[model samples]
Target chain A: MTEELLRLDGVSMQYGTGETRVTALSGIDLTVSRGELVAVMGASGSGKSTLLTVAGGLTTPTSGEVIVEGNWLSQLSPRQLATLRRRSLGFVFQDFNLIPSLTVLENVTLPLELDGFPGKRAKRPGLDALASVELLDKADRYPVDLSGGQQQRVAIARAVVGGRSLILADEPTGALDSTTGEVVLRMLRSRVDAGAGGILVTHDARHAAWADRIVFIRDGRLVDEAQTPPVTTLFEGADR
Target chain B: MSIRQSFLAILDQGACYGYQLRAEFDRRTGSTWPLNIGQIYSTLDRLERDGLVERTEADDSDHVYYAITPTGHDEVAQWLVSPVVRSTAAPRDELAMKLAIAITLPGVDITALIQAQRQATLRNLQELTRAKRAGGDGGAGDDLSWQLVIDSLIFQAEAEVRWLDHSETRLVRAKASGLAEPMPIDETRARRGRPARGGVPIDGKARA
Candidate 1:
């Protein structure tokens, strides 16, 4: 049986109070199992970013339970939550977010090192992640030396390092050209196929096509969801 | 692509009769655009008139083949090397025309029209995506051409979806900023019971 990597039950988030209250999410129930890639699509201010933040344990939902890797986020202590985030979850952002001072390898290994793993211990996993992105040869190169596409690959490597079970990417391809964006998305898809669960927040339908499923949000609510049929089905009735 | 140039290029390969040329064209293109025999014969007749192709000796079954002339070879080569020119005149786009007129006409629910069109475009996008995925594995020898054709269609459908989304956003912004508003119909004139022009009901029946 596949393992459930993340789950949100009756998730709702609101800011302020009374007339000033703004509900960012309302009754959002979602799940991401191992080897699954879910795409969250919506217009700006539709709570896609908030959903990712809540799912990654960076923000606590007002009155709901967020379970990641079998642990309830609300139940974990602040330190425990931080450790969980450092060890179990990985994030990819639109800006590529690599530390300018660090080399590719160092950027990928930073999370492991912050979780108390020694540099020597983190080296293997860091190298493995870089290799997964086909960038092992660029391990020693700093972010400035690489192209935009290569830098995004490095960011992907950092997100998947240390065998993290969940990957949350917010407009991860927003910075790259269409061709480069596809390459980054392909890498993310392969990583998810290798058993990590992922949620991709994007506005592009073409980008969302890479996901196994697409969830559409509107006005802080789940408006629609679609399961992309396998490519085999897509080819049916096509002249051979 | 010009059918005339395509036929010349194909004839450059070898001499072929009209039916054979049509079949070969269909085979090469994966039948994306099937050609009619009459169209093929007419094009061949025109090519012959232009001194680009000549009737070859008849075969055993009396099949008269057409072979590309030296001039035709040059034309084919030139066509292959030349970039297609895009006309500056507006293309006949039904959706664009509809929306263009709809926005100016009173009592037209522009937002609803945009939403409806968006949904239809999205549906087309989904179908095209499925076809693209099915044709993605261009493993077979003949599959590559078909895959490329499907990819082109997929790209076009995706662009349409993007355009629809952009139009919706622009319309919303325009409405929010009061840059676009439904022109108030002359209700007094309508109440006088005069028939509306161009099907726009000036009668209170028309939506605001």
Candidate 2:
């Protein structure tokens, strides 16, 4: 079986119409394996956001294919893609997209509720995911009552509550201070440690430091990948 | 390995302080490597905290003497044979990261990275050389210690520039060879070598 859980084959994404149109992604390809933490880094307008959108099935590519969890994204219907996203993918946005009226617990449980889970049972998973982020105690507080970092943690808890096999965080720590950012990063890293694959998007070198692999992107192209292997004697010699 | 192990490895051979370790590192690497004294002291403190080294009130007044623990001996021996874990922070290693990403990146202009590094290294080399020449031509009494340091920095900077030049040439050749094809994801995989598993290389042979 292919070890890759997500892949893009000759993918291209374009913006605008005809004469003035810009090619956001051109002839791009990428693969992310299970249990790996991959970072997507690029400068502004580099199609990094577009690639993340396509990889998460939030948008479609103009050409080529996106395969997630061994199933071709093109093969799935709109409803199927939506379902796949809910069950298999966890998404963290740059802004903490929690509902203002909802308490932290309610916001996290919303995904499970949308999937037809009963409110009472959904609460259990919501709190569990929150505990993973060390925010379970803040479950009853409204978004307005929480700080920006806390809200992001709530968003993270919501993303992971449904047992997603792949977690997609797009600049998850972009809104927090460095110390808080490190905390958020460690929380994201814990997912991979617990056996889930993750794709982290960040332009900050410091922020991307925790990834097992970092894939650099620019002008819609796959530039390079850095892998972190377990320390061994061979690694020391090779590094030297 | 623990901080104690590192401290013991450095001190077990002889009594030395943080500054001495920095000098020793430069000497062993043929003065082709330099370490910041602050980093050395910080590591030393951690080692001391871990009880790997005992501090002695030395006469130098400028530095403390450190003696290694027995635990340090066993640890260093094991560490020498153990495989080093490649750090994820490699991307932060200014030169290594630049080279690793030089080929695949678009819009980065590898020539620019190389040129910038070359210019900076050359500037430092020239500055140090001038300083050393002035020091040796002596309007003041000779201080061999400071002269040795300036000499070390000059050589190290020269070595760094040469290494960067070699890397640039390799990159240019790789691109000319058409091996720099628009980086396909699969091509990146090929360059990444065999997977972490004990797999053979793409050519059905074991990688040396």
Candidate 3:
């Protein structure tokens, strides 16, 4: 259950130099194990999204190492890093990042297809991913044809499709209403529960409660962390 | 809170014995509020004394039923139409007051306090969410009473977590404004003797 999928060791991210320099991330250490979804919560400009970008191998930290599945990011060449990201990493963003022209199935199959797999071969996995999110019937529909919630579900399917081990979601529900947002979150949670480790960066605490653990970020630093409260006996000491 | 009104309202639907009223409450509220038999009987006794309810004739099965008075029906009707008005005075929340006091003292880790409380509330919210998810999507019955009750709890826990986040931000701002600075007590009001009370100690890094 604790198989490490992603690990960030003393990761620090700084932009620019001299008077214009800014620290977007401080020395940070975090890990996501298979079957665990960790939620990162903070106010705006708190470096939550930067943490995701760094973890997903899109950006290299100024200091410290990012280890995804035991492969140190710093040691990887640009080609190796791109291959790792294409094959091992998945990213779900707030805008549902689907191409306007790509069909839902094509969008989900894009990652596998881009990794040198034939379209016909990737079709099965894409359909299965759609089925997992209960969007199989709408697989042929375009992104513009679906509701905000359905589009987000498609985004989740694309993220966890083809047995991808790690998922990085940045406010995946920001564009939907409360009910639709919950549906999208449930999809993300179900995928994580199926053994895909993930990091959910969100400002909404209600959504963060869905994760097994939640870490608070403040001013580019991890201030505190919490695990799911002991729930053996619900409302144990809370008087009705 | 007004168990009297609840009992009266249920009795308005139909007559019920003490034990039955407890069962009804459990069914209505998804057993969230465990109504013990002793409390049930005591409340029933009070209702009877207040003339809001009266004992009917014993049934053939030897079960005694309490029937609501006409006046009780009026009360139930009034309660249904009236809005629940919360008191304007601040609620007595130990956690809130503790943080209020904790922020004033030096060496106290207010962040830890808020995080701890947020964890506890999130746990509650998770359990409530899990239970709701597990219960529904099964039975066809449209009885949403349990769903509504659980939702109330979920919303409350969520609100509490948001409040903790806000509190942390406010604490940072307060520190920036020098509002959380500690001040030495004035020696001018010093007395020879002091009273013994279990008050917040003036000294010590409690976290340490």
Candidate 4:
């Protein structure tokens, strides 16, 4: 029995029916087990986004299996898939995407409310997640009032609340300054320490440096995957 | 994790000489990481001094092999889940520093620096491509190690060339549109986005 929390078995996703169709993923096989922090990197139009979306169950694959937490996503109904995504998975986008009108607390607790978690009790984990990203002090602030990096932290806080075991961040730091990006990355890295698995999709190798292993994708295929030592500092402008 | 703990973790797997440790580390990582033998020996000496490893002389071997102690085993387990301070020193991490400095100079052309880096990277990429095909090492024992290092370096150099090419284009467009100066934040408020505190501009001389 594999302890893999997420698995993709020979998966392929094709957009459109035929003729003018596009193949987004081809024969993809990947596994991310518990407590792993993996990064997905590829050039533009390399189908990295398709892989992330398919892995997170945002879209069905054209063929093969998408498994999470021991259940194949393809076997589930749409409603059940939605339920699974909401309860078991979290997402951080490049834009930070914190609701401008909501206070940081509200944003963090939004997923919990959607999942019918008791809001009052949810606040504790929400606060802890915020603190993990070093943005606890901004909890009472609105997204409009916070800097881009701070807002991204709030987004991360929302992602990890409710004890969700897997986090999928798509270019989460692309909008921030490098220094702030490093802080957000550290927070994500700490999630592995806190017993959650993460998959980060980014074009930034420096941002990907936080990951324990890097899986490179090119032309909708897994070109290479390699384990790396922990990064103590950002590698954006490395000289050596 | 402490250096001693890291040393023990590497040795607790089995007895190894300095070269063997370096080789194993490189091999396990698919040759993406290379640990120098000198660094391994120095770390072993420190571990021996700390009583975490016992150095036993081996017959007909110039290098002593080290075996981890009981304390070392316990330390390795602790280190597996330890909250390690991300190591700050990587040989190739000047980009973050450059980005941090760019924000300080409100109107300087960051693209200029990116271009310079891209040009240098492309030259290196060409050299590595030639080396990959030439098999210039005469098939030495360490030849594979050199090739692995070169491959990673080539990959990295190509990645950089691609990044700088893209970054410069976007930045050049931004500059042409009168958005050359990056958005600035107060040093105290700029935790991860901006450079080190106090808006220090990295000029050519400064980078040098």
| TM-scores of chain B, in order | 0.83, 0.48, 0.83, 0.53
Q: Best by lDDT, which number?
A: 3
List model 4 lDDT by residue over B26-116, tens digit each: 5643344345567788888888888888998874868779999998898789889878666444444688568557845777667556645
Best-to-worst ranking by TM-score: 3, 1, 2, 4
Q: What is the TM-score of chain A alone in each candidate?
A: 0.97, 0.91, 0.97, 0.91
**Where does candidate 4 stray beyond 4 Å?**
A229-240, B1-208
Per-model TM against the reference: 0.76, 0.56, 0.88, 0.54
Model 3 steric clash pairs: none
Over 4 Å off, model 2: A1-3, A229-240, B1-109, B112-208
**lDDT by residue for model 2 (B118-156), tens:** 555554554554344444422243455555655556567
What is the Cα-based lDDT of residue B24 in candidate 1?
A: 85
Grade the docking of candidate 3: acceptable
The residue pairs in collision within model 1 are A235-B134
Winning model by DockQ: 3
- Distance (Å) between predicted and true CA of A4, model 2? 3.1
Query: Which of the two candidates, 1 or 2, achieves a greater TM-score against the reference?
Result: 1
Model 4 alpha-carbon miss at residue A159, Å: 0.9
lDDT, candidate 3, B1-208, per-residue tens: 7777888899999999888898998787677788779888899898889888899888998888999998889989999999888765557888788887777677888878888888777777767777766665324454467778777888888888888988988888988997878656657865565544445344432322
| Candidate 3, residue B87: how far the Cα is off, in Å | 1.3
Q: Is candidate 3 or candidate 4 better by TM-score?
A: 3
lDDT of each: 0.85, 0.73, 0.86, 0.74
Native contacts recovered, each model: 0.09, 0.00, 0.42, 0.00
